[model samples]
Target: MPRGTDHRPRYEQVAAELREQILTGDLAPGAQLPSTAQLMARFDAANATIQRALKSLKDEGFLNSRVGKGVYVRNQPPLVIDTGAYLPPDGSFSYELIDVETLSPPADVAAALGLADGEEAVRRRRILLHDGQPLELSASYYPADIAANTALSKPGKIKGGAPKVLAGLGLPQRAFVDRVSARPPTREEVEMLDLPVRTPVIRQLRVVLSDDDRPVEASVLVKGAHLYELQFRRLVSDPEANDV
Candidate 1:
């Protein structure tokens, strides 16, 4: 609204203003946003501008619009997943490794771990909990040769944490490559996780690699949206001063 200022896209400006209000908690979750006509009058902007701004917010998952109902703030909070950390540092969460079996690797997983076609791999399933709350459902696979030395070849050998069991077998914990995505849960996952129909779950596929850069394990973790917060931190470097 300042005079003599360069102009940007009107919709972007409107969206930014609304985004600030939402983020500042001025507009709480599930709170209804101003109607398009109301916002137009308030901002003295065209209907197209307001609609575009709202559409952008909706696409970003900050707002939801229902037919015949006005736009409202999204009920679900933003997901914060931590991809940088490993599980069970000095005994954190309770992990139950249910079963392990030698099985043919699935096409997608086989490609991810760079396994040979029709190769036998150890498939281990686990159910992990955080303070009695079901936190994650996981399935992990390791190359047959790598797992053959360990007890994973036997069914139900690793009935707790795979990392702990592997460490006991002289294979220490290693680095991991993680891929993350969000989707609605399948019927089985929904029931297993005890999630509601509308709740969205996050899936992380992790490939655990040994010190030699050979992938030794592949894990798929399905986590509920509400139970965890992901955080990332970075150090800022000042160009003016070379000092840390």
Candidate 2:
């Protein structure tokens, strides 16, 4: 077929061709895709057409690529994160703290919280369920200075969970900022969460700060495919309120 000659877009045709291969088992889970040059030859199309097709698949959660590695089939689903509206009376969702560990913070994590490189921190992993369905895998981290002095620093205290223990420590409830993104889960997450190889997962990174503007906790939440939705609202501040 001529390049960009399809009545429908050529890129769409290219994406459809790859999708067919995936459905037919020709491109199995973890299979590497042909190189761009190779695809150009196979599809008898230009580099731009092949790239557009690859971009479509990637956006649809069907492919992933590393800096030095070629594209590979993503063996997981997208997580649906519920960014529920922030109402005055909303309460924290129920969760079961499954495991806790104190370890050196990862580079990306340390950077996110502005901690020194190689600093020690507490890692708490929890399984959050709603109505008995696994909703999210939540991992939270606390800086050593704060966490070390509390019950949360201990080995077994995570079982008591976060909100209760934090309240016990006298840290009043404060503000939270949530950042959202979407991508396919890693191979291990796919198996652990019992999701299909093609499912995409939604990732929510929440940073909770104390009233004094100090970083208290950071949480990474991964939700299962099509399980939840996120909502946001704009709040207008009243200028005529008391200035006293």
Candidate 3:
């Protein structure tokens, strides 16, 4: 293909096209890729450029090359996460406490919690691990008035989770809303999640409300885009479908 007006490097352009094929199942899992020489001709690139493109995909876990054979797409299935569940960690999951501090929240979080300017919130930062692997980075904030001296303000992992702690404090969570988006990962997130180069991340901002629509908790959950996909279920005939 001609470079034309596309500004990306030759190898990157080739890799991007291959990546799309793999993602869309045009190149199915376990299916061998075309020969290196064939790819060179197809992309109108040099041998080294084709090799670089293949290397990039392999580095990203999209392809694997055999010793004497050739490259094949890996059988990697994205993890599907139920967006409605708010369950505590069980035997297979664990939490690593990152920090617990009282600080002014980000603008969005401050607005979610209805905090006045300069008003501080207690933040509990931690990594949720599955099978001892980092699955998500979470930072949960609670109004200082409600969480100041509670376990939510501590560095140790709570027994059940923040929900139980909040319930005990008479602020049981009745409802919650999630706003999710996808974007490039932050430097800290890339290191923490051990993400591959060029990998994006999914950001979920959740607000848990109690009685009288009082916001009890606001949380930021980040996950590697390549590793997980959000799943939401709904009834087709439900009147609240529009709300969803």
Off by over 4 Å in 2: 1-94, 155-161, 167-170, 238-244
- TM-score for each of the candidates: 0.58, 0.56, 0.84
lDDT tens per residue, model 1, 1-244? 7778648688878987997787667888899998888999999999999998888777656799888988998775544445675464434466676777888977767987898787888888877765665667988888887788676676654555567766776666677777778898888777777774345688888888766766778888888654455555545687557666
Q: Which candidate achieves the best TM-score against the true structure?
A: 3
Sort order, lDDT high to low: 3, 1, 2
- Writing each residue's lDDT as its tens digit, candidate 3 over 1-244 gives 8766978899989999998888777998799999998998999999999999888888877899999998999986556788876434367777788999999999999999999999999999989887888879999999999998899988888998898999999999898989999999999999999888888899999999999999999999998876676888865887776694
The candidate 2 region of ten consecutive residues with least summed lDDT is 79-88
Candidate 3: deviation at residue 229, Å? 1.5
Better lDDT candidate (1, 3): 3
lDDT of each: 0.75, 0.71, 0.88
Please tell me which model should have the higher TM-score, number 2 or number 3: 3
Off by over 4 Å in 1: 1-81, 86-92, 155-161, 164-174, 233-244
RMSD to the hidden true structure, all candidates: 8.5, 12.1, 3.7
